[model samples]
Target: MTEPPQTAEPSPPSGAAPAPGPAPGVTADGGPSPQAPAAVRRRAVLAGTAVSVLLILAIVFGSRLLRDFDSALLPYAVATVFLAFGVAYRYTVWISAPGARRLFRQGWRSFFSAANFRRAPTALPRMIATYLGFQKFLGARSHARWAAHQLLFWGCLLAAAITFPLTWGWFTFTSATGSGPGYEMRIWGFEIIGFDALGFLGWLMFHGLDIAAVLVIAGAAYFLWRRMKDRGAITGQRFAYDLVPLIALVVISVTGLLLTFSSIFLHGGGYQFLAVLHMVSVVFTLIYIPFGKFFHIVQRPAAVGMQLFKYTSRRTGEGEGEVLVCRRCHEPIDTAPYVANLRGTMRDLDLGFDEWAEYCPRCKRVLRGAAYLDHVKKGFK
Candidate 1:
């Protein structure tokens, strides 16, 4: 689909040198360049290496020198190690751009600042509650979408909370008496709790993944249904970015639930094959996370910091001067500091349209419409 029109300064004076290309080629027909710029490659490599090393160290420390690590869960652990590296690498590349770098720096600064925390103690958590926890913003668009997202988010959250520690060896389960009914749980080599294998607690514990699978299946199915049926989604969706995540989720969930069914009802008829299929699905999904829509799961928390920064600033009358007003509509656009930060980012990017940020969204659309009429429509005549 065509992108929204951008407002720029009227044509530059004659014979000027072109500005540096600061924007990444997001829509480049051939994907990212094979010979990426040296600096970008360097940053990605360093970040990825650092992340991998830290993950390795964590696994080593948490697993008590691999004593608690299950050999059968090796594939899951390996996939997560790669996942951490890939996520860090992509994140480093993503934040190298001027706009994203600005946000990254400011978000962390506000997130970590003692003064900001003191001034607005509840701001960060509040943003996290509304934005990340409940995803209240999605409600403004569609209630169905909001509900689906909540299910997906909570399901994924629960799954990660359960799986990561287990895969990483931070958690381990053992037979309390070297037999069936009773079980013992350990956290980082310390005895945490015990429960009966056939009791309600054991049913919930053993079937937790099944519950997560059901939630994910419901949520992913809703999205998949919408993608298949909704014209708006169908028109813009890409197979890799849009469809595959949901498909993978459904595959993982179904195959997972099948493992349970095979154990309970099928008497392990297809349990071994189902386990292999489930593992492959999960491994592929983990490897694909950094490159696909699921990367947003990693990125969303950073936004809490950004939101906290803005909210605290507004509430405390901290850094902002007067609010900036739009030129065309004469209505408020945003706080002066925010507008200035935007202009600064634009200037750094050599966008040649920092002034455009001063106008509210409505006026910018009006200006773009006028320009379109004067230029493209007039030329057609």
Candidate 2:
């Protein structure tokens, strides 16, 4: 256990030991004593409250004390507040777990360490590009899956960039010449640019949401098709957890596009209805983010830090030629520090088989099979 950094944000009482914080819920006597449910809830409440308050303040200040705020988008803004609260609450509860807590500490602790950057400066940036940005891990599964995921990720990102600011009143659009073809865009009560409403740039600017919606629909539709048709996907499918997110995206996108279609093609007929429908769908998704599979979006970036931690740890040990190998296959499984962290996490999890982390996956499975046969088959006789 290394001494924790001085500025341990959200510190969990990590002492002056020469290591990461105490294992998930480690007792002073070196045994797992899982976190109390009440304590976890308390932490979650604090996190949620802090986040909600910060976001609310940002909304207030960024909107110039409601000067630019739109009353019509009030419900959307409220839903986003709830979204922030829920995500913080769930994230706090999740990291309270032994394994998750350890990893969380390890990832962040390594992140703040100056030694990590001194060894390899570009390591973090390279990983963010590959792991979080490109999501190359998904490509290992299938190219189609990777493509669909990229579309979905970028679509959601684009939609969020446009939607959240607009809803919070940080973004505003006004006619430059009293509702003429020229228009001006403003963010936080400051003019960004002026453009012709009939020009290509204006078309792209005004229709950005439509483009994002189309991307979302395409990506989600592909996934929905796969889930319905693929045998393997069907075996692990859950309607609410998996399918509903995609379905909700489709509904929101389709309704949003219909809103544009109604204005452009139907002379504003059914515009109000489509707008309400779109709002409802967007509201539902925002509220659903923390509790549903969308939580993975928040969790994924933090995992990139873990990859950096592992990388730097190994590089730090390169000169020593120290590598942790599988107990059976003798193949390198992970860096010594990483494996030690894993075993510590297992111990914190109250999983007695911490030694299992030392073995390769194939050897673990083989041992499991042998044990099952020996114990069960012998017991039956």
TM-score of each: 0.86, 0.85
Backbone clashes in candidate 2 total 5
Q: Which residues of candidate 2, in runs, are more than 4 Å off?
A: 1-36, 327-329, 362-381
| 10 residues in a row with least lDDT, candidate 2 | 24-33
Q: Which model scores highest in lDDT?
A: 2
Which run of 10 residues does model 1 get worst, by summed lDDT?
23-32
Off by over 4 Å in 1: 1-36, 318-321, 327-329, 361-381
Model 2 residue 173 CA deviation in Å = 2.1
lDDT (CA) for every model shown? 0.84, 0.86
